[model samples]
Target chain A: MFGLIGKMRAARGQRDAVIDVLRETTGALPGCLSYIVATDPADADAIWVTEVWTDQASHKASLQLPQVQAAIAKARPFIAGFEFQVETHPVGGVGLPASEKS
Target chain B: MFGLIGKMRAARGQRDAVIDVLRETTGALPGCLSYIVATDPADADAIWVTEVWTDQASHKASLQLPQVQAAIAKARPFIAGFEFQVETHPVGGVGLPASEKS
Candidate 1:
């Protein structure tokens, strides 16, 4: 499995708007096991997003999906900057596929 | 619920060692609902850790736990530097509490 952990900063006073856009994209992603959009407790203009994909290819494919592309475009104006994006190999977790004991 | 998404760089070539230490600390956390630790597919010296705790207080209290404190001490040598640490509020998701649809 594949995972992504990142921090996205929204344009001033646009945190909620950015989050709403992200929320709309969840589940709509094929091959995605889990997609979480969360509010940053510390930074008012930040959102923390975590995604679990079946594989790196699926995650890559998601970017080309019309909906995802639309979301990226729609969300662009509200994005201020990204703090960091880290890739990860997901072993197993709750609400994720391959949950059997490892 | 409270959430944390961050990337930790392993000292030099200690990625696997750091991951093993983190794995040992997971379930040992009382209020933690889920903790997913993964290797960074892009960076050889990085590890991505996503955590879900019952509440901010719970997460805070965890740091006071002897086991956690020990783990932190034990894992410190293997850690290089943190890329970014973002706090989050988790509403609902699979294997998480309060999963009923909104």
Candidate 2:
């Protein structure tokens, strides 16, 4: 599976705004297995996003969806920068679709 | 929910070995919502572990499980270091249990 793990630094105290924008884009996406938005405990201004998709194309496709695009635009000002963006190949794990649980 | 996102750097040429040890501990952990071990595409010697649990206590308890302890010991030699160990409070997302999806 295709996966992405990254850290997003929010502008000053705007972490919650960034998270809200991300959460707004969370439903009915094709091929999305998991997409979690979380608060980083160590850095009050940082948020972490973890995503898993069926394949690379599916992830790319989601970026083009209007809602996602809108959410990105809405979050831009609140986002200071992104760090540690790592792409991954998920081998197997719990919470994945049965077929992906190998 | 309790969550953790971390990067584990493996000794040169031992990334897969570290991954193997982690994969062996994947099943039947109570309260574990998601536990994914993925290969980092940008760094050959690094891996990312993303996890979500029912609560912090469950995560701590899992560390004491024989299989988890064994896996940690087995993977230690292959692991060079760890970085970006962030604790998070997961809000909502796909692939989380139904009760967790907000």
Candidate 3:
């Protein structure tokens, strides 16, 4: 599994825009299994995105894409500082099965 | 997939213990696919746990297990307030595949 964790701070009125960008872009990614956007319920300015990509290559490919860069650029001014971490988890090491019913 | 997200506060001296409990207990769970414990690089008191379980049942089982409960009980004193979110992701909805070569 490829995991990414990012933190961003939204500008006064850009919170909705940032969320919309995240929803549209990540939701359409081909290699995405799941992309979770979490916000500090108490602080609308703080946001974190958690994404699982099919592979590092796909994630890397995403980074090189213009749309992704544009999204980042758009959000940069609103963001305080964001760090992204890409990690690979061991397979069959006790992960939930894809077909698990519940 | 079964995912768990938790936030915990660590006492001044309990950082290592919290990490140890996470490493040892989660590493031993039969249904654990991956259990990630992340700390704010700048703040020793803040911690986040992201776990993927084999299934919802397995995750629930983990919660009911004595060791798991005990671990939480031990950490509760130091935690300000922790909330756990259990979410199920839509499988094959563009998630990273388990056997991804990269």
Candidate 4:
């Protein structure tokens, strides 16, 4: 599985801007199998994103797009902090379904 | 937000048992606002779980139940590995809906 997770804190006034960018750019990515961005309901500043890509190469290519760059730049001013992690998971086993598991 | 996420790998022989327990026990938990269990479609060995509770006290209380214990015990043989992380999320931010966001 191609998984990339990013956790970021939005600036007090920039939550909307970040979410808007996330929603748009992720949808545009070619290999984006799943793009999920969620804000911590309890805290406005905290944001978490989980993305599943077709492959690592496609994911890297998406990062080079102008829209993605623009989105990140626009979000920087309003973002308090951010962390990114990528994991390559092997397939084959019994697991839970999205709706029932989370 | 009271969020408890657990990632576990189930044995080939015991996938059904684990899923059964998760479904049953989560439904019985008193303060369980949300309980999600999902398998990585690409990888059968990978399981991702997301749980949102009313509070830590209630979550801890639920863990003490016999059914929960029995379920975990029964599934232990088939589980390759498991990791648990509980985070206390402070409220007040913009987040995405479960369906639209994911």
**Which segments of candidate 3 are over 4 A away from where they belong?**
A1-62, A65-102, B83-102
Interface RMSD per candidate (angstroms)? 2.5, 1.1, 7.0, 7.7
lDDT of 1 by residue, A1-95 (tens): 88877778999999878877777776557777777777777778877778777788999999999998999999999999998676779765444
Question: Tens digit of lDDT per residue, candidate 1, span B1-102?
Answer: 888877789999998887777777766477777777777767899887788887889889989988889989999999989986767886554435444323
What's the C-alpha lDDT at position A1 in model 2?
A: 89
Candidate 3 lDDT at B87 equals 48
What docking class should model 2 receive? medium
| Candidate 3 lDDT by residue in tens digits, B1-102 | 555555567777676567666655565675665555655555566666666555678888888888888877876666665544434332212233444211
The true-versus-predicted C-alpha distance at residue B98 of model 4, in Å, is: 12
Q: First chain TM-score in every candidate?
A: 0.92, 0.95, 0.70, 0.76
* Candidate 1: C-alpha lDDT: 0.77
Candidate 2 per-residue C-alpha lDDT over B1-102 given as tens digits, one digit per residue, 9 for 90 to 100: 999988889999999888888877877898899999888777888888999998999999999999999989898899999976879988888888898777
Instruction: Order the numbered candidates by TM-score, best leading.
Output: 2, 1, 4, 3
Candidate 2, residues A1-102, lDDT tens digits: the string is 899988889999999998888877877799999899888777899888999999999999999999999998999999999976879988777788897776
**Candidate No. with top DockQ:** 2
For B8-71, candidate 4 gives per-residue lDDT tens digits of: 7787656556766666666546766555455655556666665555567878987888887887
Q: CA lDDT, every prediction?
A: 0.77, 0.88, 0.57, 0.59
If you assessed candidate 3 against the hidden native complex, which CAPRI class would it receive?
incorrect
What is the number of residue pairs that collide in model 4?
26
Native contacts matched by each model:
0.50, 0.88, 0.14, 0.01
- lDDT (C-alpha) at residue A51 in model 1: 77
- Candidate number with the higher TM-score (1 or 3): 1
